[model samples]
Target: MKQALLILGFVLFTLPAFAAAPEKSGKSKAHGNRYQAGFTLESPEEEAEPPEDNGRGVEIPTLVVPVFEDGRLLNYVFVSVRLQVADGVDPWKVRGRTHYVRDAMIRAAHKQSLGADGNGRALDREKAAKVWMATANETLGGESITGIHFLTVDSRS
Candidate 1:
């Protein structure tokens, strides 16, 4: 019959697709059935670590401070900083006390302005870096960090 021929044609066309598929190297020996997926849940070979806290240094939350001039409210500058760990200091210890460092830096930044030096429209990187480094060092009670590096400094009016 035509219906039987059509079914035979459909099976002939689809059979090669299942036969051509590579077999899964699972423990199950029942590879005869293509519909059987005897897969077991397997854990990943290794875990991934956070990008910033990979024993290099600690990244503080971005600091958003107001840039003011002559009692006028100017644009806010967002400062992102990273503290490099000292050679002998444990990075985890410094990382654990990061909140203190951030608080001290925020207080210092509130006291000091990070406005432009001579350009009058950009942040003074030199002065800002010094303030951040000094505050972090003082807060950690020793030279817990080698230095403070500015990651980003931008302003929006």
Candidate 2:
């Protein structure tokens, strides 16, 4: 019984000392179900930068059209453009041409023209909380759109 008691006392005192030793370099074991101690490595910032692209393209303008509660683009409005083709051109061909233009406009407005998806396409409530809409204006013979006129349609927000 004396020998057993001595062995028990030795184990009780030595357990804490053993636990204080430094852990091995690689690999870590989580304690219990909660996270306590471990090494986490993130990729270096220099290596995180995206590779460069060499594609050249035409640039389009972004128009911020506000939606007005009453004759104003303050409450709620979409950032978009209404393109009307030049005169003598058939409306059908104009429609076809404007489709690509509108597509480019949407891409530019959403800032998705770059390699990665831009904030415009993101549903994030912070950065690009503003909405966008595309509408093609009808041309009157040679009549043309003098300039982008941001008009308010409806206001609910």
Candidate 3:
């Protein structure tokens, strides 16, 4: 049992050395770009039953947030995102989804970021809408954006 434990300890220590060893291939497939982040878009799920709407706008399903940011109230920052088309989705459709996802993400993030405030929900709605419209008009049309840029706005008095 003592010998087995010693062998296990030796193996554990040596395993990291194997991970740190240099690759044999001179030409690396891995490029050294720190700015890039991985993103995945999952295909839309098949609905068993279609959503029902009573004439106004479609009801956005409420997502239950389990965590909230712990901090003092700071200046509200609005992010103006500009998106460029890459793969499957077209420019116009991508623009629309960008708008939708931007709204969804902002609402979701704000709920977490501003949960402590009494007026958090109200402020997020008003500010997010303004930012979304401004970004859509100014950044979406005319010039084609190659990617996304988020500009922040301070709403603290």
Candidate 4:
């Protein structure tokens, strides 16, 4: 009975020490400063803006260019082009001129030599992209396109 009373007294005395709230330390303030010290907390209402359509761009239909070698037909290359317009530019304005844009792209593709040594072998993608960019800018009467992305280029030989 005396040992039980001692144990009960020891537990009662130690329990209050464990239950007490921890004191703030200088190290805690230093650690907190290392992360997000100068940052202001934003309310939920301030972060509720709608997502912007940054990647909403226009895609042109596939273009087929015929490759020939010495009066003989070789194969055709199918190319898909996408144009990303600059800010404040109306995408529909470019879309409405699809016919002219397609014509310009076709003309540009035809000018590129497919083969390594002009033997009508493969698609000249780099040259085609350059020419297409130039032609599209000329057709649009201004530099409205921010970038030209080639989505696909397939050759059937």
| Candidate that would win on lDDT | 1
For candidate 1, write residues 105-146 as lDDT tens digits.
888877867777554435676787788888888888787777
What's the TM-score of every candidate structure? 0.61, 0.24, 0.29, 0.56
Of candidate 4, the 10-residue stretch with the lowest lDDT total is 35-44
Alpha carbon lDDT of each predicted model? 0.72, 0.35, 0.42, 0.69
Question: lDDT tens string, model 3, 1-157?
Answer: 9999999999999999999976888687877567533322212242122233222222222222222335444334333333334444355554445545555555555555633246442234344444434444344343223333222222332
Q: Write the per-residue lDDT of candidate 4 for residues 28-82, one digit (tens) a residue.
A: 4333434222322223353243234466467889888776666566667776778
Model 3 misplaced stretches (Cα beyond 4 Å): 1-72, 114-147, 151-157
> Which of 3 and 4 is ahead in TM-score?
4
Estimate candidate 2's alpha-carbon lDDT, on a 0 to 1 scale: 0.35
**Candidate 1: misplaced stretches above 4 Å?**
1-54
Give RMSD to native, each candidate. Answer: 20.6, 21.5, 17.4, 22.5
TM-score: which candidate is best? 1
The per-residue C-alpha lDDT of model 1 at residue 89 equals 83
Clashes of each: 0, 3, 0, 0
